[model samples]
Target: MSQTTLRRKFAAGLTALATAAGLVVGAPALVGAQATEQGSSASLGSAGSAGSAGSGDAPNTAPAFQPAAGNENPVGFRNWLRPGCSWDPVASWVQLCDVWSPAMNRHIKVQVQPARFGGNAGLYLLDGLRARDDWNAWTRDAQAQRIFLQDNITLVMPVGGQVSFYTDWDRPINLGGNLVEYKYETFLTAELPGYLQQHFGVRTDNNAIAGLSMGGSAAATLAARHRDQFKQVSVFSGYMNPTAPGMYTMIPLAMFDQCKCDPFAMWGLPGSPRWGQNDPLLNADKLRDIPMYITAGSAIPGRYDQPSSLQAVFNTFNGIILEGLSRGSTIAFQNTLNARPNQATFDYRTTGIHGWGYWNDDLIAARSAQILPVMNAQAW
Candidate 1:
């Protein structure tokens, strides 16, 4: 069949699937590309509130920070730490904080949902290319707070990092009119974790990390490079192979077009060691023995989505192209790992798109099947 005919058939199939699944059809909203500019400084304010715990207790008004053991630094945590710029009380058990990131030289927000029953395991959720400064799309769009509220795990969702891929850049990039210094790798693996452990009772080791799209690739790279830090990792609709044919150009183009940021500042030139170091496919061997979950879709629009405008249709088309690239890269990474005895779960759907609906479902499934299991383990 011709390409157009195939797409129509796919859409019809999705419509049937939607009908069978009882999905509510809705106008297509921009999944991860809604935010146009970075966040500006503002005094912290309470955005919303939730119940105290997963069991529906009174909202907990207890202080979130305490001087726990090993928390005190000779330099003092107060020297650079600033908290409570923004708050989202998901429940009596869940709270989000905007903390100043000294490494990135700016304030970044993290959703802080304390683990139920005092569990020490933490889960970090990373966002995609057009990550907003106000909140991670996971919480704002994916209903992630509700998904993990009852679980015995701290949910860490850092806000903002548009087109950053969450990596430690060699130099600052001009984003729109502002020069952004992206040191997300350091903030996540070091500064943020230390803060969580000291103040929130989150454990540094045996943590779980997951991300979608740009964040997904970063999750894999970070988990592999910092194997001692993360016990489990998941990547949904991520570009795993950075050095694949046409990827060097394609990636830069995507980054530049999204936020007017130079991709070269991210990891040096295309053939540099940084690219190889960050490529999850090339570093697949480093992920051995770590429980991982990688998922992607064919980029076909699903039944729950409807293109209501020309911009929506264009955005949907763009998502298709980007997700198709990710699917191909993830499959290649999966095949490379087949050569070795590794523990990884691959979820490649024949139909779907790189939208919030699929990613939300993926997060729920990964948390239940892969993340929680490894986290609840008695030993690593």
Candidate 2:
């Protein structure tokens, strides 16, 4: 087929995939709306709970932690959307708030679904490798707003952290002649937390973090480094042992493929200590006593697989290989943690791949088994 025809076909396939998965909800939901402080009775399903003995069964009902009546949001915090800060409503109980990231020299968007009733507990959801600037995958693809609509924990989903691994890079990364600033570690751990606490009423220290794919490793690393900031952490298909044998070259190549960005700009060079420093496996010791939930699939086709079209087939193939690698690193990290009193939960699926569906499952499983229980946010 001609190149133009191929491009059109690929676009069509993407549209179909997005439509079938209901990823088009963000554009309409970005408008301003009002959210009532009420409790949610939403319950999780058993699908993500399948695998290990402690994978955590779905609770019969959501948590019942209510915030102080007049302290949900600061006075005049919901007046408008932009101009600095405000509670911009998205859905029944969701709001989009933007905060200034001094390091990045711009405003960063945070999609929030406040807990039913209100609570100081917050859950930060990180996005994958190709995270977009408009919205987070947790809310866009995984439908996190719907999933946690009734839960009593503020959902903090920060948008746009494409290939930086959500880390504080040594320097600015040049992506195809465009320099992109990545001070994510500082932004997430310090800047964002302060904003959430001051405006959203979420406690800076009372939080949990979860992520899929690339973001997964970031979640682990951040939680390990900033243990006081996070009570629990869950990694879905993350490459914990990033400094493992072939990864030195694999990461840079993947970065190049994604945006022609120089990986050296992230950590200096291959043998830089930052590489090992950022490796979740190397820093697993710091995660001790922190409620940990880690998961990776077998890479085989599973329920969410749809290899019907050319784009779908290509995606499935890529996902299988990626998940296979993630499984190896996940197992290695699990091994490092297993040497002690097993405080971590590992959910190794017999059949699955690296995709949003399985990551969504991992999120629900982590919440039920580890996150909520550890944060005292579950009603089980």
Candidate 3:
């Protein structure tokens, strides 16, 4: 039998899978290309809001869910480029913009997509600290596999803060001394979804969240908290246990050296909440219902494993070993999933690490049969 047929059979057999709008069990007529094909178009259109479309619960902007000409894929089908500007001006695939949250008391630079394949499914992507504002931050080789998402999902890359860990600092204020805190949680959950639909024409319900490294944990947390909003979630090399054994020491040191944050300033020393407040492990229950994908890899000694900026400093701490710590995320992730009976779907790979290569692979898997079924069913 063809791989697509297997996928269909397996998907059909997922009687335990979450409820979806459409499902063809046991070779239920394949629609798009498989992983090797890399380019396939899924059928989709506007769906009603699970909540309210473009309704601002906080300070937010909303986009539209309209599919346009030259883009047949709709939000979930096409993977086209959206133009965005940032610090000075440089042309790039991911459009970078700014978002201000009075609740957070900070101005955040966000990367937005006008529309990918004219589809309505939206994906909020996060970047690691050492990564630049220009790149998507997670899953670097997107240009190649973007075809998979073409007409399949809307890709939104948020230019993650330097060492922000995508967390809303527990402190009363932000790094720049802005008396207001960055309400990332609200922005991501409440505001951002509405904003995407109003501006880009994406249906809010037909969306999911995914990311790499630390961002992966953020994805888990969001999906868990708002499973009603997102149908699927994916994490590549995510931290399942923030307070994992030895992490309190190693993570702080790694942050100090690579992220350039005063350990005292960011986490307020070892016994502080700054470090552990947002670790997904602290709130594993929140992620129990969301379907997820996770992966990681270890570093090669003396080889360029991670981005130079991060790898250089982390290398001092037996970076290879630090890479090994990625297993911690995988372990914690497994522990939680296994504990629950069909809690959430997962794809965990022990062969990769906190780098772009692994992230790209995770993205592919998340977009594959494992995760896309949830996404496709999300269509109204």
Candidate 4:
């Protein structure tokens, strides 16, 4: 069939999918994306408020640092330390390493927790739309180091990539008086993985990837595109269909709100093949062999919500709408998977919103239920 015919069929299918998922078409979808970006900075601060035990309730009282065998530094892997990155240890297990990314032409900091008993499996955790340069939210918001301390697997979290969607863009972005290049797909799939294998004893192919919000979709995309490299994928509160009705516009608006970067530069114009190519729903067939853990909330306030405060109320409102949108897209993706022999686990929460607390819950659940087993890593 011709390209135009294929595009029309896809759009029609997307509209049907959205309607089936109970999503009001154009404007509401756009509003959800806008509100998500607007509230991300403030709402993100209330991470780990879920009131759940495993979901960030325990304190990070890991044992004192100890250097691995044959390594000199207190935290292990000193011998393999690259020049640009040094070991910045926070807890007994966590090490913040700054590694160079040639694609972006800058040094990127990665929060790492080496295996406690020396294992080869690794998990790459991704950040959200407003991802900061100094630290990955997985470390700042959630207690990843402590939670995974017993697991004989490395946790690799890369810092930064605000509004970049962790994808390789067609052009450079000028943000805050600096030109930033986003080749995150290249960095994560190729460059960073090489460094991890050499330095952290992680196999490039024996890995799992997880992310929340923007990073969630990115995790799925990266895993699908590089199936040989990533064995398992998990997405928490992610918009899986970028080419769905209103999402093509919604993604760019969110990008502009965060970095004033042009969305066109990231994936050409709306309806371009690149948009569909990057969409997880459109590429669902490619993931049939990969195990996936996908989740989203009802957008209702759960145990984590604090409605008394004004900022909290605003965040609650934004969280509801944002998660509702994420739910629509995620459910649509789930429906797509249902038709095929896809290996996916879907978690549709009865009460929750788009924030770190639920993502922490999802991550913990995924690790125990799917990730560890898929990568053949030991939980304890």
1-380 per-residue lDDT for model 3 (tens digits): 44454444432322112112122123222312232111111100000000022211111011222222343334442234323344322222344556565666555566654444455767777655443444443323333224343345566676545455655555643434444453567777776666667656668777778765556767777776677677777776666666765456545443433333343454466656655556676666666666666665543332223223322222222222333455545676678667865445555443432344445555665666455577662222
Q: How many backbone clashes does candidate 4 have?
A: 0
**lDDT by residue for model 2 (289-375), tens:** 888898988867687775554334444544555677788788889889877775788889998866666777777778779877788
In order of appearance, the predictions have TM-scores of: 0.76, 0.77, 0.64, 0.81
CA shift of 265, model 4, Å:
1.5
Top lDDT model: 4
TM-score of 4: 0.81
Residue pairs with backbone overlap in model 1: 44-85, 50-91, 51-91, 51-92, 52-92, 52-93
Worst 10 contiguous positions by lDDT, candidate 2: 36-45
Off by over 4 Å in 4: 1-89
Best by TM-score: 4
Order the candidate numbers by TM-score, best to worst.
Answer: 4, 2, 1, 3
Taking the tens digit of each residue's C-alpha lDDT, what string does model 4 give over 1-380? Answer: 44344334433443444455564545222222222222332221222222222332211111222222432233444334443555555453567777788998988888887775567889999988877777787775666765676677889999888777789998988887887888899988889888888877899889999998888998999998998889999999888998887776556655664565566888899998888889999999998889999999886778666555443454555456567778988988998988978889999999887777677778778988998888888643
Question: lDDT of each model, Cα atoms only?
Answer: 0.67, 0.67, 0.48, 0.71
Candidate 1 displacement at residue 348 in angstroms: 1.3
Selected candidate, larger lDDT, 1 vs 4: 4
Model 3 misplaced regions, further than 4 Å:
1-94, 104-107, 114-117, 139-149, 172-181, 262-277, 298-319, 343-350, 377-380
